[model samples]
Target chain A: MNDLPHGLLTPQILVELDVLERNIERVARTVSAKGLALRPHAKTHKMHEIAGRQLEAGAVGLTVATIGEALTFALHGVGDLFVAYPLWISDAQAKRIRELLSYVKLSLGTDSIAAVQQLARQLADKKDKLGLMIEIDSGHHRSGVLPDEALDVARAAREAGLNVIGIFTFPGHSYAPGKPQEVTDQEQHALGEAARLLRADGFELKRISGGSTPTAELADNSLLTEVRPGVYVFGDAQQFELGRCQWENIALSVASTVISRHEGDAQNPRRIVLDAGSKILGSDRPGWATGFGRILENPDARISAISEHHATVLWPEGQPLPAYGEQLRVIPNHVCVAVNLVDQVSVVRDGEVIEHWDVAARGLNF
Target chain B: MNDLPHGLLTPQILVELDVLERNIERVARTVSAKGLALRPHAKTHKMHEIAGRQLEAGAVGLTVATIGEALTFALHGVGDLFVAYPLWISDAQAKRIRELLSYVKLSLGTDSIAAVQQLARQLADKKDKLGLMIEIDSGHHRSGVLPDEALDVARAAREAGLNVIGIFTFPGHSYAPGKPQEVTDQEQHALGEAARLLRADGFELKRISGGSTPTAELADNSLLTEVRPGVYVFGDAQQFELGRCQWENIALSVASTVISRHEGDAQNPRRIVLDAGSKILGSDRPGWATGFGRILENPDARISAISEHHATVLWPEGQPLPAYGEQLRVIPNHVCVAVNLVDQVSVVRDGEVIEHWDVAARGLNF
Candidate 1:
């Protein structure tokens, strides 16, 4: 309990180092025991310090969502990198990719035949090896080539003199409650089929990667050589709702204060407004989420509405409510997006301050 | 033109000095011509540099949504400040409030009896001078005391020794297309009824404030003495959809390059992909917005989807599409939120680089 005064946690993200270490250890152990490589996605915790911990915990490498994110990690000495996003390689990006291949091993994802041809043409002069992963559309209809089209894409990449290493898919459908098991099963089946098809076409399928936080536990690592799961290290409202993790297991939270209280009817008070709003706790409410966010200490309270700077929460029944100016902890709907919204996060241990880490990779969306 | 290389706009926000000057002059002229006190909300452009511009444009004071924002502006020498949101006052905040009152004229809003009582008790020593604005629910329905409950809260504040300055409301419903006139009409009616009710109870209603970007143009300044309108300085996708301004009038945009292009199909030969996504351009979609966002220079193109790091766009028919590595400008859906995501914005004029201004108040949401 450092008496650093309240409100010093302005735009702050409090992370319990103990809980974070536990999560990292658990995920790494689970994946390693099952003989699968753990390529923890850097999108969840963008800090190099956290990435170093993951690597120390036996993660084979790190996965990122964009070239910019990969470069951010690489600059901090992260060598083996896999950009999981289906990147559209331009001339400038191709040059950057060639340069990156010189320092570290790079695996890029592609979902289009045109993209595969473009990458091959751009890297014709490069002698360094670059891995290519063909993205398969398992269930999420956002982006990815259909499983039936995987072989054609793989053949095209091979003909273009690019290394067709493996298949990858994001089982984003596993995010919903009670759906993780089924979604994971579907994802495993999709990856297995895609892998077999590539092998039948005389292409070497070196890696088969699939998993999200909700489906990571249920993933069939028997066939997958590597598992990439982000957001599992910092459980959020989404993980809590999916029954993947408990509130106590949550590692990240926004420390906010009750700036105002509205006492309408004693029996059914209207709402308890907090200083933490959409701006602090990102306004990302998945379809099944009960509210914009949840109060860590006050479980029964739900944030009903959020403006740019005000979060209106409805209090629970038969509970002692907080008065104006009281401090509260908030667990956002999506921890990854919420953490990205802030400039810095406080690394806390047993309610005491440890150190402050700047979100160096924040706002690197492009 | 500055002849700067492509992708040289280091900071995201490009604030053209000449265009901003014209926008400020226009808004000030409109307020003066309509006989209303202009208190521009600083939440849109958090930079004190821009706030100073608004003050130089004849703004009576500045309106912020949070105490943190108020403190930030106060540090930058902004004297008169109005925390427009109905805040919850705490002990820690009370001390800050007292310190702020010594330097600037401070006015805060309250929509509930409990909040009013808390604020009154907190300001017991300085209640004689601190101004209080009763937030009236004027069709927005987010947070504000109902028109009927305004007098009760006002009575509580007065009894507790706080000075009741006036009432205020936000006509957020005016953001609809071609509905500004109707929304402002409702706003004026609500202000009139709330003012009359407070006056009947022997409370002096010194100021009646209302107006947002959409309703500002149609606001009837007869009843209200002051207006608070943010987002007028930088036109966004919402303003474009509401027919308030043309695409060319948009002062802010995200500069990105075509990192990938798919020319496989002639019918949709030009599928341009950008590096900017939800993190750069906010994921906010107004009900009437056609797509996630619009492409600058190419109005026919629409941003089809946004993943964490990729922006997929479908190019228009019969147009010369940008090749890979060609830079393009994107006008985001919501300029205010997008600006908050970055640390700095580039100030440009006539395609020439002017300067980079820090978003000093970016994360001051708390």
Candidate 2:
């Protein structure tokens, strides 16, 4: 552990190569064993290095949240990409998407007739080059239409001369405690129903993508042709608390230092301040989440509050508080958002930093 | 408004130059009228263009949250910079800080004896060149020491041959509902008591910094020599909801397009998905916040849920839902985090793109 340089900056993301590789291999192995394809979401790491590793581990392609992210990985030499979002493309973006199709197989999600028709009009002659996935609402009612409503979007795509590849659903509700298995069942049911309806309408469904980090392992291979689990590679505090992964399975952590310490008083509790906070770790706390984040060195130490650059940690009772300037690894509550906050991440193996990977698609939200 | 380019990409930040200038000038006038120095925290905008405007508006200096942010502005010709955080500097950072002091009037915050002693040891002969401000906890209870405890930290700085120039506190509790005036009073009391104690110990203090966006206007200018207000430059949903600023006072908003529309059913309510989400808007909803964020055009519309690249918005009861591909301006819950999420912001005047300002100090959270 001493191999991590002293005087190294705080709030720097360190990706443990050994653990990261193991995470990638394990996910790939599980998917392959079930005869299901894996298209690991690149939105979590957003680095070509991690995407390359996933592809090397037999992933069929990369899954991204936006067309910009797809273009990034495509430019990085990834030949196949799926933009798993209901993209509302502008004419300029359509031109870029057309250019991207020249070098890669591109697909995007759609849940509305207006969006599909708009995409068809924007793509014009290039419509055939891109594929479309009908998004279905599977308990997580953020985006996506109901299962029965998938046929309307698919029909719209067909009428507009666009290719309807398959359907997908995000089991996001699994993020809550004791919901993984239940949400997985909902995901499978939604995708299965959408596929049944689309197939009955003589649509050839080649892909059925589903799964978030929490429900990926529990995904039914018969229903989901591929899994797009983004956060499984990093395994954040949310996943750890949800029992989706063990603490040892976490591969990425922010190296932070205790900047100030305060002893308990009547009004104030015993606490220490860490350099890592919302700006780096990200402010993403689900109502069910225990706190803002977790201290990897001591999980019992709770992050009571987080400001832009200050994470106030309540030290575990009876445990010696970290001295001022003492380093601690902080696991963000949501790894995806935290990773997006940084431009690059340090890749380490057995405490030695092997290389640094640029978060090539860091803010490609468009 | 149609001057905004057609087919512009979604999830893009638009900084309205007219509103931005007015906001800056208003704050400058307020501080000038109160006879208080205005050191606008550049952490909110992080762009040199905005900092230049603030300085031109008669700000005493630029306040940053980290040393890296200070270095960015310092390199950009911002001669006066204060890193208002209890920075526990490493040896390499100390060297960089010393190099910065050669050109910029650099001051940092400290709340611990160990941190002051460490800085003294790191700087060695260069210790006299740097100034320290003892941080006091008015009510934020994050990083600062208590009002009375500020003297112990100051004594340590005085004993270590470091310059203790003044004291500072962040009345962050003002962010809550109905708490701005109360927090401002607490801030004044804490700063007054800390200054009194430090002055009683025969230490001459020059600076008494206090204020956050919520409490900056309510600050007692008689007690605080200078006030640091960051989020006022580009008002966000938080400030607007807290009744600190009017809706039209907001200077920055994300341009987003409706991607999907869902009519209400027995199971789900009517909603539409936007291209902007947590990845661009940032996930920062205070417990007292109304919702995740707000649609600038329709304040009644609520961003019910936000994923990586999808914002699920609940359209108002009587208001017509935006058509698929229709664009709208979205105000993020926290403008500071939202600005940091993007690499560059498009400056607009009368809807025409004026310039693209780089977020030079973005993600420089050391």
Candidate 3:
């Protein structure tokens, strides 16, 4: 970054080394203290360096949201991976999974018996087996089956020669402020009911994987054998707003250059525009979000509006507005989406570039 | 696409070749009929195939939003290109532009005198000069100077040894429903006033580029010399909702496989989950957007919710919900964003995959 000119790449993703290491070690130590298997979701950083660092820091495995992402990490030598998405195993995906089985320890998530049946049909001839985890719907209501239906899916997986390990749930509702405890309770309740039902059905379930970024710190390890949190590796504005982390905990931000400024009205005399638009910071503002994103340097200045390639920040009156050619760090509302939008992120330490990690699984959405 | 299994590697981007060609030809013909130059914005599809075809259809050039995008197209033999963005060129970027100028006819958008001065300092030593377009603030206040400021920016560009070509504006406010005419008029008024001002400054502007997808068809020809519409070749739900294009005019969509289903409540019984999520279709819903996206086969079925890897479509009651493993076509809220989220798009004609176009400039935000 120092070698390049001042405003070359106007908006680029950057990771502070100290913040990143601290964030990773904090979660690793917490999960260790709780005696829970730490499986940092590879879906967040999507970089092999981060995954390698996570595993080196005592992460048992790396969890991912898709087989494609899992394959990317597996190819990069992440030996154990759990695809925590309810996948409908198509023939090609089944073939890919079978190929992956030869390289690493693989686990799949299933929410329906139909997907399990299809998996059974496709992988019946494969000699290797992949672990299956039935996704239990806690409070997100986006996916997953009820606890009662977990056994049925597990039964189908067992019948299809797949190993039913345990169950998992995403307490996604925890993303909102003041919902962490309620969402964690919901996660434990759902997983507990599923585990009990599975045990009653005579299934010896092992690895119970669950937890989102918001619920990772609050989830009880007694209920979940393993925890998967993606965004904790790169704290975002949402996490800060939800009180999951402090301002210093935000490890990732879009380094944008101020390109223009204009006074729309007399009262709004401090509107500074930056090149970090929705294309760089991403457009993932929840209804309760203050604005599109917040400036790390000027926390009070909010990105009042955004176009595809422009962030209009209505700077607060007290703080001096950024002039042309000035660089500012923008904390996006959702770091995961912002990370996925970029090809690489520059890892910095003490204001110096250390490494540029490629977002390897950036567009691997299949 | 037909050669693949029922549910493999979806939710994949699928483009109907016939529809894509027709849409392209329709816009090209419309622009030609008005004796206007067609420089389709490559930021939408980011495919060399589409840009090549647009040029083949009598397009004067291709318009892009970044220098990185310009380099990608220039390398692919796009001889003429325009970066329709207010760029704060770093030394590295200025060098990149210098390199790009060696390959093609390059013009850039600039709204500020500082950027003009920087361009002059960077390109002063170079023998070859690049065209400059002074961006006028239309209805969108994202970037661009007001009409009155265009001459100052143009004067700075001329002084800096840059050839001032024309004025341009992005009437982005036309995106909302019932705002096309107002936005188009805004575009004309802004560009007309800027052109008049620049002409009065003794500069005969040549290429007045303007128009976005919503205001493309409604724009007055005499007011602007060229039209740069990104999403016209692949209409999205936003265009459809704004009456800019009909449902049939939508040439691109995500081919998603139904992975799960559930009866949520007594009233909302039909819910089919598809593999297409925000990762594939992109998360770009505005406040007024209808659901996340609409299903093509079942238009009434709105994707009520979306997760990172799952789209839950709340199928309207009285219609039989799609079974598991069924394929559904989803029209995303914005085509440009959705296109950027994928690696490649499968081109289809007669229910068969004809070719695959790489999103070559997918993440070229720099």
Candidate 4:
């Protein structure tokens, strides 16, 4: 552990190479054994190194949330990409998309006719070569058209000369505690119905993409051809609380130094201030997300409160508090946002830093 | 407004150059009128252009939260800087600080005897030349020693051959709704007591720094020799709701395109989704904060829900909803987090793109 970055900086993202590789192997094995294509979402780690590892582990393609993300992976030589977003592309972006298409096979998600038609117009001359998926609204009522309405978008894209690649849905509701099984059932039903409806509409629904790290394992291989999971490679506090992964399975953790130790009062005796705060750990506490995050050194020590540059962890009654300047590994509430907050992450193996990787796709929301 | 970036990616940060100038001028004028030295916090905009403007407007120096942030500004010719947070400096960072001090009049924050002694040892030969400020716990209760305990840390620094330059604090509690006045009063008391204690202890304390955007206006120039305010330069939803500023004062907003819309099923009557999600707008909602943020086009519309890549906003019944692909300006709950999420911001004047300013000090947490 002494090999870990010390006296360098506080609140720096540190990915254990051995653990990260194990996480990638574990997910790839499960995905491959189930005979389903693994399109690991690059939006989690957002590093070319991690994306390359996934590709090496037999991922058919990489999944992204934005054109910028897709562009980053494509530029880094990740050939096949899926922009799993109902994008509102500008003319300039459409041109950029074409530029990306010239280098790799690109797939896009469409939930509305306007988006399908717009994409068709953008892909005009080469529309027939482009891949499109009709995104179906599963239990997660964020985006995507309803299952019954998937055919309208599929047919519209086909009419516009784009290849309609079946349907896809994100069972994001699975994030809540113990809701994975229930949300997975909802996802299976939604995608199954959308594929059936598209087939009945005289369309050959070839591909069905089911996404959501929490619901990925419960995905039926027969109904869902592929599963796109981003956070599985990270395993955050939310995932740990959801029983989706164990603490030992969390591959991503932040190295933070204890900056101040305030023995509050008799009522609250063990409160220590950490350098990791909202700016680094990220302010992503869902009502159910125990605390800001769990202190890996002592899970019972919860980050009771957080400000922009300080995290106050109050240890339950009798546990020993870390001394000022002591380092602690913190598992953030949501690894994705926390990863996005840093410019680069130090890759370590058995306490020794192997190398540093740039969070290439970070802040690439555009 | 038509000349503004259109058909571009959604969830991009847009800064109205005219409004930005007005905000800077407003804060500089306020601080100047009070005869207090203004050292605008660069952690807000984190851009060289804005820092330059503040310096041009008579700002004595720049205040940064991290050594990296200070270094960036210093490399850009920003000579005088202060790292206001209680930093945990490592051996490597101590070396970096020396490099910074070579070009800039740098000041470091210390709240513990250990930190002061460590810093003194690191700067052993020229320890007395290094500027150090004992951070006093005004009312935030995050970091800093109590006013009464400041002497112990001060004597430790002086004994270690270091110069103790007065004290500093952040009235962070003022961030709560309707608590600005009370927090400001607390700050005055804390700083006033610390100064008196230090003077009686036979210490010549000169630089008494104070910070807090919400409480900056209420700061007493007689006690606080310098004031640092960051978020005031770009008002946010929190500020607007706290009556600190008005809607017209919000200089920064996310230009997000309407991605999805749900026409009620009796539950949610007029709900629409924007591409700007937590990854773009940032998740920093205080309990009293109305919503994630407010839509500038429709202030009544509240982003009641948000995911990583989508913000679900519900408008008041019967209010017009933006069409899919239409753009809306969103004022984030906290502008600092939102600005930190993006790499570059679109600078517009008269609704036309003038230049792009890199969030230069972004992700410089270390």
Candidate 5:
């Protein structure tokens, strides 16, 4: 991979392999010491190489959002896989799921009784055991049934001969700055209530999974059996902005060159144009984000706009801006999505190039 | 490629060889009838297999946006390539450019004399053989020199001993609905003026190119030497909404399943959820776009919101909503970005599965 030559890195993401391993170890140790099962979400680093590393770091298993991701990790030799998203299984997808279940210990999520019933009908005669988790909506309204609705889903799964494993909730609202503690508490409350409801319905709740990166540190492990933190392994602009991580903790960045420069009007004095744009960094600026993303070398230079080929940055005063052809690294706002935008990432170790890892499972958004 | 088990097409994009060939033939024949040299941009369909077919369909050459893309194409034996973006070359990039120049005819675009000067310094010895195209800013204010400034850059390339081939511009404004004719007219005017300016500078302009899929149908071949249209080969939601293509012309789609349904309050009755969301269908909704993208089978269902894994669709009143586990095909707003978001596309031919072609260049965004 290193023989390909230098400039071959275009719209390329550079991940310091050593730093990534450090971050993974830090999170795993924290969760393991807290007596919580660590299941790093594979969505952040979709590559099998990273997944293998996480498993070696003492993670019990891996968490994925899509059936496609579950299949990818399973093929890569990951034994225990938790598909955290509430997935609807069509006839075609059911067949694929059954095949995946035979190869790995699979745990699926469902928020509704109908969904649980549908899954049960499909898995009735299958020899492989399928574990079903009742999804409870902690705070994020995207998916999951309310804590009160968990019993019905768990009952439905049990009736279908599917094992009613436990409950899981994604405290996505924890990503907002200063809200991690509150969201984590809410998550615990929701999961505890769901567990009680499932027990009352005569189902054994073996696990109560919760905690994203932002809330992992604040999770009350007494109520939860496991935690899933994806982006902690590769801190991004969002984590930095939320004060969840330090700059040195950031493991991935887009190494781009200053392609052009535009001295704006007196109102906007300093501006530099980068070869990295939305196509490279991804046009994903959350409403709360300060800019498109963050510049690693020049934090003062804010990304003002993003065209397909150029990233327009508004440089801060008193800072000498990057000249044309100068290289700079940028940490994207959302690292997982940014990683998905490229084919491979250069693994750098202590300023020297180590290897290039193919994002084998990239673009598997299905 | 087709020897895998009946349902082994897990995460890889399965391309029906016959469907892709038909799509390529249709677009090639359409442009051929118009007497325009068809040079499909490799940015959309990055697979070399598809590009080879385009070349076989009488496409003169391939158009790429990045040097990395050109290198990938060149590695796959595509000789004639046009790097369409204004590339800023550093010492590191210059070395790669030199290597590429050794194998293929490389035509690069530049909008500034300073950029041209840098290219000249890099290609000092091989200037006589290298190709340079001056870019004109036709309405999109993103990049490119003004038509009036094209001569200065062309003269700079000539002084640098590089061949001033022609001029090109991206009529990005053509993406707006109902503006294709106007954008095409503006593009032609800019190209014609730039050509005249270069000719006045005593430089022979061999290629005058401009045409996005939206403007291709309205482009006047009498004034240009070639036209580069990328998205026409596989029509997308943007094309369908802009009146550039019909429902039958959309050859690409995300086959997603309905995961949930919400029977809303009396004021808002029906809403269905799909597995596809921004992660699958890109969140590229121009202000004028109807929604994030469009549902191919259910035009009445409007995609109201897209969370990470859930796409909420508001069904029209009295319409039969898709039941849980029902599959729906979604045509994304921008085909290029959407295709780049996934590792594979299921190529369907006459409703029969065929070969699973890997998107080898899936994430070459850089």
Candidate 6:
């Protein structure tokens, strides 16, 4: 049992420093071995301390989901940052982007001609300071243009006096069961096709970024120059259930005390309520997820349901039910969303809290 | 179209003041007419401004889900407060609860003997000032004990020298389709049975509380002394889909700009990506929810998928897709979770940003 800090609040986020350091080292080592620049997505941990550690472990830059996040890291003295989402910049964002460029080497992703035009109109004076990456649709179909259409976006970006640096795609579909390798193949093909088209059109594709947590290790180094994988640093239940990572790799968990418990009859099963719920753990259960989340100590137990402040964990039958007030560690379904839900996390080593890291960029999704 | 403020950030929460006031007024008026006290659940909005408005409209107190939340409101001068969840108080919480009781008329819910004993042990000196409400299991089996078991808990509270105030239950099952009325009936019966048992056992049942957003209006005035409904002030997509409220009733929405849009092929449907994803809109789709959430203007449209920073809105087939960079209001699946995700909300009046309210109690689920 982890000895939580005395008077530690329930539903508090606990980052296991040893496990976190190992996870970061392993990913950094693997990416270095493959000769791919690692831009660990700061959106997962959203902590300056973690970002500093990633940079120390040889990360090229930090990948973020929003310009607000980029600015946060830039202000915190992180020199290189990439806002990896297709941002539809407002006048405020355009100004912020300009301000960010003055301090850090910043790049942004663009998927449409309209966005490129808007960016040019908003930041016309600072066009040379901005670097754009044309987003390719690979197979996720969430954002990004089709691989064939990447050239049009690149041409528009160049014509509008914006620097088109490269192409990128997020194989988000890799999150599904047994689909990482297949998604990585699609990612490589998409990047390869986009790069070829852009290159044929006299565009020097300096960067070809692709990868989510599931496909990060399987990234084709020959085709992709960089990879942006967020959730690997703090492996979540979704990653664990998808067989992408093991329980030992999960570096972050919610320290929640059991508040209520019930032994069911014929129709129902034994259950316990944890102080941790969607408010802290977040409510991001993918369709393929086993349950709401996983109880770290009891792999067989499932977090059956969650409300704002109550996670109803279905205790595995015959396993001793944890006594009321006993604290347990719960791995959330999606670490990125979970991390965004908190303001700070307890950095613990050997079951003792050593420091607290502010989730400085949390809720900065502008 | 609502004329938003210039340079307004995407995925920013915008709470319509007119609609919010109306929603609050309507609920307070209804509960007043029904001769029941209204304790608006502050967990939904977590704003002192909104809580102040609710109190001005005639709320007996504010209902909170955690001691942290209660403390937030109590410190903000919300004189009467109740932490309505079955809290397993720690030493820190007990100390905080005692501090809370020193200023506010604070009450807490208990369902188990262990929790009651823990409370007694921790707050022995403050027993006279502390109020305990035994939570009765209505139809929602999430928390609370069986209605018949209320007497035992009340006895335990009395034995512990704690002030037993009443009994309460959350008819959470009302959130489903065709379940509100039935669940309200169950709530009445449960409260009535529990009150009867406690009164027969010489326990004074001064405050019988029950009601969620779906069953708030239908609450039996003779049975429930007070109704605690959190979501009525900001009707969500879930409430609308469940036929609990109309589109006009929704007061809170995420102001998100369209970042990317694509015309679908044979395999997929056309979609637009909104900057408001789970991080801002929240990922709380109940089993019966129509989609992730509903768009205010485009009611037919569905938020088909969401990542941490992108809400993939599947636009209606014939509806003209929103232009790139156009801002739209995206109602979250659950308003409470969405409110908790942000630090502040832009309070809009007559389509103009008037003020910003801090989400003071947000993420205060300790």
The B-chain TM-score of model 6 reads 0.97
lDDT of 6 by residue, B1-366 (tens): 355555678889998888899999999999999999999899998999999999999999999998888888888889998889888878888777877888898889999989999999988888887789888878667778887777888888888889899899998878889998888988888888988888888888789998899999888677789999999999999999988898888888888888999988975569999888889988888877878898987889988888888889988888888899898889998999999999999999887899999999888878
Q: Mind giving the per-residue lDDT tens digits that candidate 3 earns over B162-265?
A: 88888899888788878888888888888989888889889988988888988888776787889999999988988887788888888888888888888777
Per-residue error (Å), model 4, residue B310: 1.3
lDDT of 4 at A98: 82
The CAPRI category of model 5 is acceptable
Q: TM-score of predicted model 4?
A: 0.97
Model 2 lDDT on a 0 to 1 scale? 0.88
Q: Chain A TM-score per candidate? A: 0.95, 0.97, 0.95, 0.97, 0.95, 0.97
Instruction: Give one digit per residue, the lDDT tens place, for model 5 in A11-56.
Output: 5788887778889999988888899999999988889889988999
User: What's the lDDT for residue B284 in model 5?
Assistant: 67
In model 6, pairs of residues that clash are none
* Local accuracy by lDDT, each model: 0.79, 0.88, 0.84, 0.85, 0.78, 0.88
User: Using Cα atoms with residue i matched to residue i, what is each candidate's TM-score against the true structure?
Assistant: 0.87, 0.98, 0.96, 0.97, 0.88, 0.98
- Candidate 6, residue A85: how far the Cα is off, in Å: 1.3
Return the candidate ranking by lDDT, descending.
2, 6, 4, 3, 1, 5
Report the lDDT tens digits of candidate 5 across residue range B40-115: 9988877777899999999999999887788889988999999998777776678888888888988988877778
Write the residue-wise lDDT of candidate 2 on A268-292 in tens digits. Answer: 8899999998999999999888899
Q: Which 10-residue span in candidate 2 chain A carries the lowest summed lDDT?
A: A1-10
**Highest DockQ, which number?**
2
* Per-candidate interface DockQ score: 0.31, 0.83, 0.58, 0.66, 0.31, 0.78
Candidate 1, clashing residue pairs?
A259-B88, A260-B88, B13-B345, B13-B346, B14-B346, B15-B347
Worst 10 residues of 4 chain B by lDDT: B1-10
- Cα deviation at B360, candidate 3, in Å, is 1.7
Model 1's CAPRI class is acceptable
